[model samples]
Structure formats: structure tokens, C-alpha cells
Target: MLDFAIFAVTFVIILVGAVLYLYPSSRRASGIPGLNPTDEKDGNLQDIVNRGSLHEFLVSLHQEFGSVASFWFGRRPVVSLGSVEQLRQHINPNHTTDSFETMLKSLLGYQSGMGGGANETVIRKKVYESAINNTLKNNFPLVLKLVEELVGKWKSFPEAQHTPLCAHLLGLAMKTVTQLALGERFRDDTEVISFRKNHDAIWSEIGKGYLDGSLEKSCSRKGHYDEALSEMESVLLTVAKERKAQRKQTVFVDSLLQSSLTERQIMEDCMVFTLAGCVITANLCIWALHFLSTSEDVQEKLYQELEDVLGSDPVSLDKIPQLRYCQQVLNETVRTAKLTPVAARLQEVEGKVDQHVIPKETLVIYALGVVLQDSDTWSTPYRFDPDRFEEESARKSFCLLGFSGNQTCPELRFAYTVATVLLSTLVRQLKLHKLKGQVMEVRSELVSTPKDETWITISRRRKHGEQQQN
Candidate 1:
């Protein structure tokens, strides 16, 4: 009997060891709170995916499981830092840049030695920032030009016509960014038109379905993607060659030409920024219009700011700072829309947030959208009130992630500047009206977008039109 008991104890010990090794994610984040195992009845992947909009689902997680929560993204454990404290601990900005930025670099394959390693990456990053940073003045005219083109196009349609706002916004942003990045050739090149079509096709077919392997699984899409991507590469490479030979101008492509990075490197960076900027900027315009369409009072206030700031003068850098209320409207727009709902960072070493351990090389998500509207952080978190940003104390209370926080990304700033330009131009001349009986639902894509067409009628703002005519 004694010998049988010893053998049974030894067998149990071995089995327990095997189980722990096989399912390390369970123990890796056992201390964190999240969905009950039973709640995830259909497996973690399916449960999270089916939870309606990602914004709503994340809000539910924060409400039910507190701020710091963990879940399985497939077989791996993924922790979401949903509280300000959790974000501070895990997202030590002084030590590392935004994980979302890093994730972007990795996804766009920018980190892969553009010919070298850390130094190469750093050099390219500096070039990108420098190229874009000095362009507000240079780009403003291009933006105005594009907005005028868009305005004329909108006016061509019959009165009170429903134009697809997202598509138009996408064109405005794409034209602006590409013109800034590539240069004057964008104005007349036939390849520019071809590239835009390819870029949009990639967004519809590949951008939304990238993670699910649907991109790779569908032979038809895969072929279409490859052909489009290849053609885009050819066009960009041709442009790069021309830029390399030309007078050294200060455009993004010119700055890239001055770098030691390979042609492929420059092309990829341009592609990434153009693709990202198009989606985010377009969404910004779409949501800002949607909110303004529903709220006439807000529109009237915004128009007042534009009138006070410019008084029929052209939009310029010097005048931008004086439009505080327009800035507030934008702040409110980003807050309500949750433009970038989630951004992930790969933890290079083991770290802890709120006593919860983050294992090495684990992908950790910063729930910016959830934190932005956290009841503990914002007053009347669900309301779309721009005045909330009127107080300095409100901003200091919690970080707005990529919006106005001190550590906000440059891309976000670029989008903000572009959106402001568009709004200033439009609001000064047009009045936007929401479609009657149409309810808008936001779908979680690479960026969040309305499920229904952003249906709205645009008419010239009567008073402003009279001012313009005079």
C-alpha cells in the first residue's frame, strides 16, 4: 500500500508540470481580472470579435473587469492597460516611443534593416519627422487648393444631393498627403490617378481583412492585392528615381533621397504614411461633419470662431492659433469618435503594471478609446461637449493618448491640422445637414467608420455665401 501511494503521488506531480508548461498564458497573467472563462464560451477569439463594435466591447470590458484586464488574442495572453495608472506604468514614454508606432513600423516592415539596423531606423525616423514637421506653411496652399477643388465638385451636384462624404474626404486627404509627400508631379501625372485607385482597392480588400488571413486565403484578392501593390511600387520607384536626379527640394521624397536608405525603404515608408493618413484623416473629416450636422448650435459657434479669426482672409498658420473654439470642436470630435480606439506595443522585457506582470516580448494594448471616456477620468464621459476641453485642469487630469497629450504622435497632429483646414474652409462656406431618420453606427476597421453611408446634404451657408459674393 505504501509503494502504490508513492507511485500515484509521483504521477500526479508529472501531470501537473506538463499542464503548466502546455498552457503558460493562464499562469502568465493569472493575477489580472477579465472576462470569466465561462463568459468566453465560444473561445476568446470569437467572443471578442462578435462583441459588436470594438469600442463598445472594450467599454464593457473596462466596466466589468476594472481597468487593467487581460485576455487571450488567440493562444497568447494580451493585457489591455485601460486605466491612467496602468498606462503610466506600462507605457513609460520616456523609456520607449508609442507601441502603436512600433507596431506600425513592424507591420509596414520598416524595422527590417533598410540596409542597416538601429542607426538606419533612427535616421529614417528623423528624416520622416523633419520632412513633415516643416510643411504646415508649404502644405496649407495645397490643402486650400484641394478643398477648393472639392467644393467645386460638391457644388456641381444638384441642390440637397446626398454625396458620399467618406469617399470625398478620402480624396481630399489622399490628394493633400500625396501632394505633400511626392511633390508637384502629383498635379498632372496619370500614374497619380492609377495609384489612388490601387490604394483605395487595397484598403477595401486587404486593410479590413488583414488579420483574419482572408487576404492570403482568397486567391482572387491576393492576386488583386499583389498586382496593385506591384504597380504602386513601380510608380513610386519611378518617382523616387526622378527625385534623386532633380534639384534637391524640401519635399518628403527629396528628404528621403538624401538618406542612405534603400529605394524599397523610402517607398514602404511613403506607402505606410499615405495609407494611414488617408484613413485617419478621412475618418476625422467624416465624424466631424456628422457631429456638426446633428448640432446646429455647434456649427453656429464654429462659424463664429472662423469669422472672428479670419474675417474673410485666407486660412494661414498665424491665424490657426486664434481659432480656439474650432480646436475645441476638434477635441470633442476626437473624444466622441474615438478615432484610434486601440494601439499595441510589444514589451521587450518583463515589466509590471498595477502588480500584474507583463512577460517579455508580449504584445500589450493601450486602450486609448476606453480610457478617453472612462467615467472616472471625464465628466459626463458620454456627452459630445467641446467645452469640456475649455479648462486646463481637465486636460491635466488624464492623458488623451494620441490627441492632445504631451506625448501625442506627430501623425495625429498632421491629421488635426489638415482637418482644421478642411473645416475652416467648409464651415465658412457650407452648412451640413444630417439625413432624416438615418441612424449612424460606427464599424471598427483599421479606423472606425459609420456602417451606413455618411449621408448628408451640403448647402452654401447663406450668410457666409453673401459675404463671399460681396
Candidate 2:
């Protein structure tokens, strides 16, 4: 089933590209107002391609059409909802993290549920969720220790030294995720570095390989990619075996070992958590720091909140809720960056968004980018203002889109905790400043990132007594 899902998606992508090349236009199938296919075979795919990404295309589509819109991917009609009202009508309570699961499985070449029964599948998912949740609760001290180590590294730098924000955060995320997810072996810098190298090799080929048939076309790329994947699986398998033999229940792999999952199932879940957790956590921290650097007032306000809430003390899990402003900053960063800009689901049964009837099995897109920056929903939506989320209604609206609240997926919730801990620690100590004339552009993809290597310089904040003496 997993393999078929992967193949079907890849086939559709190729088929869409082929059809778009052959045909020039497609008519709308739903009542939702949106673009007709620019080409008959391609549908609106060429338009999406021309815009560079789905997020950009949807932004323009929502602007032209309205909150509810429709488009085509080859011959299949896609319904996109760009407003809270539209999403409320379309959102289903039973929606699981199937998309995230599928993407991770495809990227890692992990075929899940091979010969496993439905009960086993359900148990495996429970284990996966339990591992993450338990890690956050049980291993938070380890999390704090790792983040403070990052802070210590930054402090060691000479005052006002330029730092590569993305690179450093990615490293921090890798350490934290691997240590908590895989095992304590990742505590070694050497191990983390090797894991990251293999991770990057596989990540670089994610959409380029089996999905597009490039892996089959390029022998060398395929060989290197397979080698990296094999190395990663080997590492995960070793960790699982160690945990099972030792009967350890300290880390994420231990949780999986406690379950009845096969070695393959355990390894795949670890891979999914590692991949998603690192990327999302790294990007979230990067954006938070970038935005804080650009706005002195917001940064200062955040620092003040930290001081007022946890003076001369470290941020702990118990005190997280008290640091409400920190949560606001993280939420606003997610909104402003438009991180994870697009999410999709296949309509299980016929659905209705407003008056539009979405056909069963049709593709439904949640145009989160369009909704995040919608002027009607947010005041000065483009502005980096954390105060905007101070409102309960705003937070509720944000949660409605699956960015936060109980609705947020486990990986994202983990990220929020990690970002909160990092921000609370870093802001209280270092004063972050953007490089002069640095212009950062958002590259919306699986996750949003700076279009280029973003550089920032930091200076140590003066102590309260030192300021008074000065």
C-alpha cells in the first residue's frame, strides 16, 4: 500500500507534466471560482510551474478569485480554500498526519506496513507519537542542556561576529533531534556530523530521485544516494538493537523497542522523526532569530518578558506557559514566514466548501499561505509583529490552520517547544542584530527558508548592574 501510494503520486506528477505539454486548457469542474487550466493536458500546472511554487500560485489565485478557489492538476480538479470560513467548512476532525507520514516514507525509501495488519499499523503509530511526546516530557533537561551548549558556543564568539544563522541552527536541531530520537550516541559531535552528511545526501535527492525518475537515469547519483540511505538505516538499526538488548527506556528508540514493531518499522519511524524534527525545528529557530534581529523593539520586548518571567533562572517546562510572549513570537514567526505554506488532502467523500461541491477522491488544497497573509484576517499581515497574536481570537484563527493548539501535529509541537526554549535562553543573553543592508527573501517550499545564506551578528547584552554602573 505504501509503495503504491508513492508510485501513484510519482506517476501523477509525471503524467501531469506530460499532459500539460500536450494539452492547452481545462474547464472548471466545481463551483469554486479559480483559474481554468492554462493547457488542456497540464491544467493549471504550467501556471503553478511558472510561478515557481504552489504557495506563490495560490496567493495569486486567491487574490484573483476569492477565498474559495479551484484549479487543475492534469485532468484532476483541485479545490483550494484560502479563508478561515472556507477551511472551517472543509476541515475534517479525523484528518491524521498521513501526508507527513507519506512524505517521510517516500523520502527515506521506507515502505511502511509491509504485510502488517491494521492493528499493528495503529500500534506503530501510537508508538511513534508516544516517543515524541515522551521525549519532550522526559528528556527536556537534555534539550535545555543542548540548547544552552549552543548558546555557550555563540557566546564564545567575539563580540559582533557574523554568524551563519541557518547553518548553526541546523546543527543545533540535528544534535537535539538525534540525541532524543535515536540515542545518546548522537551526543558525540563526530556522530552528529556523520549523520548530517548522510541526511543531506538523501535530502538532496528527495524529489529529484524516484519521484522524477532521475535516480534511475543517473547511475552515480543513484549509487551515492543509496549508500547514504544504507548508512543511515545501519545506524538506526544499531541503535534499536542496542536499546532492545539493554532494555533501556530512556530515549525515543526505546519507546519503539517497547512495542511489537519490526526492526524495519522502528527504523522508518526514527527516520521520519529525525528528518521532520530537524528541518522544522531548525527553520523555526532561524526565522525567529532573523525576525528578532530585524526588529530591535520586538527583540527587546521579548527579552523583557524573559527577564520579568524568569529572572536569573533557566526556562523550564513548568515555566513555559508563563512565558506567553515567547509563544507569541514563535507563532508570529510561523505566520510571517508562511512556513509550511501548503498542505493537501484527497477528498474521502464528497465535501462542501461554501456552495462548492468537491467531488469524492478530488484533491483539496489548504492554501495556508493565502490565509496566513489575508488582509481581512490580519492587520498588516506582512509585518513582523508578535503582538498581533496576543489576541485570543488571532491565536484561535492561527490554530484553525493547524499551526498550533491541540490541532498541531506532533513534530510541530516539538518544534515550538524547542524554539521556545532556545529563544528564552538566547534572547536573555545575546543581543541579535541583522547585518547592514541584508535583504532576506522567503523561499517557500516544504519549509520556508532564506533564499540565500543569511548572515547576522550578535553582541552580548549588558548585565543590569553593569548598565546601572555605566
* Candidate 2 C-alpha lDDT tens digits along 50-106: 786778888899889888888887677888889988887777533544444544574
Clashing pairs in 2: 19-41, 20-41, 20-42, 23-40, 23-41, 24-39, 24-40, 25-39, 25-40
lDDT of 2 at 140: 97
Indicate which candidate wins on lDDT: 2
Badly placed stretches (over 4 Å) of model 1 are 1-11, 23-30, 35-43, 52-57, 93-95, 109-123, 155-159, 205-207, 216-219, 397-400, 464-470
TM-score, one value per model: 0.87, 0.85
Give one digit per residue, the lDDT tens place, for model 1 in 133-210.
666556677777788788778767665699788878877787787788788787764745776888877666533445
- Predicted structure 1, TM vs. truth: 0.87
Model 1 residue 288 distance off true place after TM-score fit, in angstroms? 1.0
